[model samples]
Target chain A: MIDSIQIRDFRGIRWGEVDGFKQLNLLVGPNNSGKSTLLEAIYLGCTAGQPAHWEGDSFEPAQVSLSGRDFLGDLPLLRVLKRHRYHLRKAGQGPYRDGCLNISISSPAAPLRRFQLHVPDLPILPDSLRDMDSKISRIEIDEGAQVALFACASGRDAGRAERALAGRILQLLSPTQGAGSTRQKTVQSGHKTPSGPNKQRRTAQRGARPSSGTAGPGQQTAIPRRPPAAQHCIYLWYPDLTYHSAGVAAWSLTGKLASPEHVLFFDVSNTHYHFYKTFLRDTMTRVPGWTYKIADCLREVLGIARSFDFHVQFLPAKDNDSLIQGWIAPRDQPALPIDAYGDGTRTALKILASLLSLVEQATADSPAVLLWEEPELFQNPRMLNRLLREIARLIEGKPLQLFMTTHSLEVVACVAMLVREGLLPADSLRAFRFSLEEGTLRSSWFHADNLLSWLERGMDPRIWDTLGVPLQFTLKEQEEGAE
Target chain B: MSAAMGGSIDAFYEGMTEKKILHMLMQRGLLAKVNLCDGKETGKTEVNRRLRDVVGPNVGTKQVRCLVLRDLDERETMERIKQGLQTALQALYRERGHPKAVVRFVRHRAHGNVYLHTCTELDVRVALHIATYRHLPDFCKSTIDDYVLRVALHHETAAALIKRQGWSISSKRIIHKVTSEIPALLKQNGIPMMGEAKDFIHFYAALLRVHTSPAVFAEKILHHAPESELREVFAPLRAAAEFLQDASSPSMPGDRLPA
Candidate 1:
């Protein structure tokens, strides 16, 4: 388990630390109190080495330059540079050109492992492409020192500019082997092969231009461009591993990020109906045992009897598209389309289906982490209570860590009740109340015993004032005021 | 005056018996002002343990004095209650580290009536008193209830209620039940009668409005009753109030009452 997390200069969070984490951690706060941001922070810290986990949209630059007519083509490179500059400025107010994200994790038997992702300064645009509407001249691509520079010239040497641009982009996407280990192959103008070692070597040897003499105006020479000034590096420090690499580091320390088979995140607000149907279909086809278990869980928590069924209609062979419809059958009633029920039912089904799928894949050696945001939405108190209880039971013996954020006091109260009844151990549960102070998020933890005591005293856990010390009054004033 | 002397007299009670008694004393002008501790027996005991810590030994040459009142509550014997009181007093004295302080029984006569007072000397002065309600000469068993019933039920409306609700029931019991149920009945069926009947119901209507008990209603009545009205209602309680006033008054140390 991750014992604690300290977040700084991430999103709206300036500096905040939540320590003493347990198997189950429930985050409760008012809306817009940075609960979702904190979840995103944890996900980012855990899976930072994976390029897929780093959402490109969240790192968009504050300002976008719209001068280039081919600005859309330059967006990918521009976005990367702009994000680096934006974070470098936001990390601190200085001339610093690099921003670092420092993440540290530890297990029970191993020492702490710290990973640092240092975003280097934005690459400078070549002189040719600096002017507006200037056609590309000579474009050079280099793989030395893990840096690729693009140098282009404009005016009369504008022939095959677009093709040269595409070639350079293709080379950038493919993996570049070490500097002097040359097993180079070449790519002629209009042929691009998908991934393979041969394709990678061929793409690298081709660089950005064809070797044919009459291919284009500036395609004759293929001298390699020098590496850029600033280089992005990821540093990893652990007991057995201490290395820094200039490219995205392969997360060899954990298999989950490398494969990403066990981790799941459900944002109910953005999930589409088709996505949930697809998930249900996949789960039913892959793990037939979990279909009944998930159905039982839904019935127990939501107080609704429902089963998943897919209606398939096969047409003529010439018409290759077949229609498959998924419906939820209520007991002793006609089947209704999954969307016919309320969003609450749909959300519960989506969340439970995904969780059951994770449980199916979980092993004793490798546990899964499920991050759920706003499970309390569209759910009443009774439903929320039952849902939380069922969730506690679902992950009981499995190696699963559950992290959820809720604005419902009912959910918190139910968790407290479970803790009091010893269904969930006091040490296994951690509850934190988040509040915004001075534009930064701050959190206060409620010990399980203290929370149980408060509930036993018939006090509302959400109201902190009720737990304060009783008021003391002077005798003379009380007597004088007495009727 | 006693106000110029910094410390003031304070009273602690197990319940409302001493609180009602103190109100009567203040109304009869026997005591200028008495500070009442605002808690029950357990809370009052905690206050007593912490009294020395709060007020210190003396406040500018005037020592803080306290009066603790308790009911006999039908113990096997009055001696048992007195022994319990003595043990509690000793614990308090020891806790305050004033073991050698003097304790004496002082008697005061006012309006041809006698009342007993127990005085103790801690660094700050203290006193303890007992009210054997069933044993008091004029104010007999349930004195406060009897006083409230007499004042509220002597009107013609109450007499009619007594006659209608069956005179076999005690007038006090009928008044208690009527006062307890009148507000709810009025809310359900509206006011049934007019004039003095309405006023009689309105007088105890606070039972529902504030969710207070019959005991609390009686205390509120005694707290707000005028001196002449209280004197007419219970002369023995008035005499006891005079006795307490004379005992606590600095000016009445010797021969302060009329013969």
Candidate 2:
């Protein structure tokens, strides 16, 4: 649903923009082409405010003490802003300049919103302490959330000021509270402060929780519970409403939005056999029907008549810790432990399980984006072909957007052949070849016509050899003595 | 040739055979300026696509000319292959919706030169010379084998071997068998092909080397050739420099030959 994305001074990319994205986009290139970096950038941009959930790390509310780095964990909203400075100058863009890491998203439903975080020069401090700084920064979200800044003094006075500032920022981000309603109560850097009921509410909220284990003796004890007014604040940071709202709107325009799962990424390089089995087991637990679908897909694609069976047994010796065991049952054969299968079979099972899980979660109205990095790992050509075909079916009638990066020519050829054969819609598929040209990252879109022509001529579609000239030879005259 | 003067010739070939031939011709001072294409052949469709891209739309105005050289592959006759190439070119121009042009094929019997001219409506010339080699000529082929034998054995021993063996077996088979038989062929004897012989054998051996065997005589043996032995090996190729020199002359535009 993202029409285009422009990235500048982010990770390895100096400046690059990819426009005219299709439903299913394939980023094909050699290693170090910034494919993974691009995905990371997208993920970061979408989940900007909620950095704790950014890497799928579990959120612990108990980590909200008013001392040390642990307090920073409570306010995940500010973590990404602090990390923005680290992204600066890393792309070889000279000395760090005072520029916001700009992520702009546009949609037909809403006006363009440019989420700008003015990366400050100071090292990242806990939110309780950071409120003392006087530098006023404004982040504008067009027709959406508008963030206003206020300053506070350090020490005991600043702790109360920090809570007030947090409450105010939360007010700004929360959709239920209008920016117009909170205009008169705006606290200035050194002068004005919130008094009366708002201050008392924040003070009460700060006094409810016990001090964290890491909190110092001087630090305030028992941070209070969040007030009901700030309950709607965290919901504003939901990926569905913030980063991927444009995609949601795009989907709505076409009429479908049943599920809220936006993005799923599979990094095959780090996914070991055990790690994959665990992920499959977790998905199967979440969506029980997905297990059967995965089994059917494995049998149809890999020609392996095996069904997954998972059992959780409690161990009394280890204080009743539950251990999950996985078994693969073959038709008319004894059920064997899933670890007995080859890595390829396990990888195939994981991929199919992930796809089935996405399908189970996706609805006609709400579609998800699947980012698969190197699915070709440990998969042979036949398995890859079947996987692609299954993917083609998975996207049918569903609002799923699939993005994959691969170095396999077989995968490229299979996709091209599928499009050529009308198994996948030509318009839905897009291929981009990323290359480093003249010390700058660049991408070229391969036209479907050219790809189909290459396939028709029995040439490797992945190799863009047309950019170079062909070698030639002079004809040899007939030998005099020989026939 | 100075680097400044090295940009004039635009010759495209099917594979390594033409590249070696052109390289040798350049070394021998037969062709002053030549630019050989550096890619492997995919198929006729890709080749035609490349032809249009490299040649550009204004074919008559540009000084750039292309010469396509391919072997007379066993599956097709020389005339049929030539016709197929011409048809492919015409189809490419038509597919691009370019103005129809008169395609004329010319072969000079005296010089053994073949030229295909694609002329505009106004008779402006845009030419592509096509040539096919069934096998390397006897002189070049024999010279390459003799050089290989000399490098693999002592002169008297090589002469005795040639005198005793004669030309009953194929030169490629003879070279393969003799090189394998002599354990010290690569170590004791230096590569015999250098200078002219290196150029000639590279082309000659590559042509015969296609499909029949994976081993290339020039790459395996010539890579081991000592610098001192190069002059003697290249003498014969230098002597046949006139062949390339004769082909470099611009052929008459209107000359038409029977297919």
- Give a tens-digit lDDT track for model 1, residues A271-382: 3323323344555567667656766877877775444332211122221122122356655667665556677767776677567777776665555667677778878778
Evaluated at residue B40, the lDDT of candidate 1 is: 26
Candidate 2 per-residue lDDT, tens place, A127-187, comes to 2214322231232111112111111111222243333323333333222222123232332
Q: Candidate 2 chain A — worst ten consecutive residues by lDDT sum?
A: A53-62
Alpha carbon RMSD to native, model 2 = 19.5
Q: Would you estimate the TM-scores of all the predictions?
A: 0.40, 0.41
Best by TM-score: 2
lDDT values, one for every candidate: 0.42, 0.40
Residue B198's C-alpha lDDT in candidate 1?
Answer: 22
Model 2, span B174-245: residue lDDT tens = 454433433245445775423223343334334334221112333234333443343444433322222222
lDDT of 1 by residue, B156-178 (tens): 43444445435555556556566
Residue range with the least summed lDDT across 10 consecutive positions in model 1 chain A: A63-72
